[model samples]
Target: MPSTLHETLIEMFRERPALAAEVLTGPFGVSVPTFDQALASSSDLSAVMSTEYRADAVITFLSQGEPVHAVIVEVQLGPIEKKRRSWPAYVANLHSRLGCPVQLLIVCPGASIARQCAEPIVVSEPGLSLTALVLGPDAVPVVTDSVTARRNPELTILSALAHARTKRHRAPVLEAFLAGLDIFDQEHAELYADVVLAALPKAARAHLEVLMTTTPHRYQSDFARRYFAQGEARGEARAVLAVLEARGIDISEEARERIADCADIDQLDVWIRRAATVTKADELFA
Candidate 1:
């Protein structure tokens, strides 16, 4: 889920801080100088991840072309206090190892009685502290503009979640909700989903067939059935095969047989999309 959202959010934070904040046009919308002065920036925080023992999608804050802070931002969809120990330790580790002023930022989906973070969270030693940015259920307002709506189509889904009552109507949230199956880390996934879904509208993602399926990608067997059965995508299967072959993906007879044996239309649909990028067709085998 972090893969779907976070890195892109650094831009939303930069280009449109208001969207990152809950308010439409208030103090939250004010752009930070950090974005303006950055000669350039990147989400390649892999180096920091190992150093800090933390998540990868951290949004780095730069000033005067120097890395001032690397925020180990955690999106806590569950219990924020539950993660207090791990998060602060991660920040402490980053600071000691990397000698950079690392900060921990905790973001909850919405306000909760369980969210007891009233101060800068500290851990391991008194020297390390992490800030909390918690949003309530109604925070991170929905899109109201035609241009923003067109640009960030993913917002439609987040907006829908605001009013959704049945699980069936939450397809948009479910499409990116890989954490429900724990396929990805749940807290990380929730945070990632928040940033990306808020930044883009669901319509912008219409081209991606994975979103249309009822069977979540975490359910490997269901992908083909859920997606392919009702899918309007053209030559999807052939496209999958062609892409795999052209990419020089190593395909075995057994693997091909397995794909053919697959009855789940949704799984096939996901496989077809993945085939378009696979370096080895063997990856498709169960």
Candidate 2:
């Protein structure tokens, strides 16, 4: 099954086909010709009598109704030999159908996977090779400034996904991301929040939860409601456990399990108060 992160990344490109062009020219410094419009082209590159070969997305840049360039956008989370093999075919078919030069853009969140995808693929034709333009964590710029993030919200989302692991960049990156969320509708904002939250490290995610509570204006979508609830439950659970440990109470395996498994705020509140003074860890439940 395709992960939500993978689907969200693809949907971003599909929503704004020009984003592919922006990435190609922005980070990779590829010279893409000026186009009047960018359209989502057919990702189906299968020929007659051939097995189905679908790509993540195909974007065609048009100038005066003529196809000038096409881009094959593939979101790769991990190294897959099969995908590497089929990439050449995707480029070849798109070029043949559109009668324009085609470039393969591989989006990888991990640097290791990006390096793997960046390797050249050799074809049967002598001296013929296809080198994919890879957008990895290194290529993705950390948009920490709220002004820049608001101006280019799409890129901010990409930055969050790519640089979520970086501690120094986490605060500003998350701030910009949450600020940009207002540009999207309720549905998209929820999905974007889910993707950003899931991509961040544990510490970064906890920090974002803090921001959500302190600055509720930044997160006014329905997603915020659900995320805040889950975060509160987790925080309460941790507090209960912390108090038990601090009080020198010996917690049994079952007692610890009960605390960890709890999601109710009211129940967790009771347990937290009990943990501070209870003689036995198991007494919290009583």
Which candidate number would show the highest TM-score if scored against the true structure?
A: 2
Model 1 TM-score, 2 decimals = 0.41
Name the regions of candidate 1 deviating beyond 4 angstroms: 1-31, 36-52, 92-103, 110-130, 151-286
Tens digits of per-residue lDDT, candidate 1, 119-178, equal 567553858466554333344344433344334433333443342323443443443332
Off by over 4 Å in 2: 216-286
Per-residue C-alpha lDDT of model 2 across residues 1-286, encoded as one tens digit per residue: 8889999999999999999999998999999988999999888998778878899999999999999999999999965799988999898888889899999999889889999998899886789999999988999988887788778889988888777678878878877777777677767987888787887779888877677666446543344555567678989999999998988889899988889888899999999888878999878888
After superposition on all C-alphas, the RMSD of every candidate to the true structure, in Å, is 12.4, 7.9
Q: TM per model?
A: 0.41, 0.76
CA-lDDT, candidates in order? 0.45, 0.86
Q: Model 1, residue 142: what's the lDDT?
A: 47
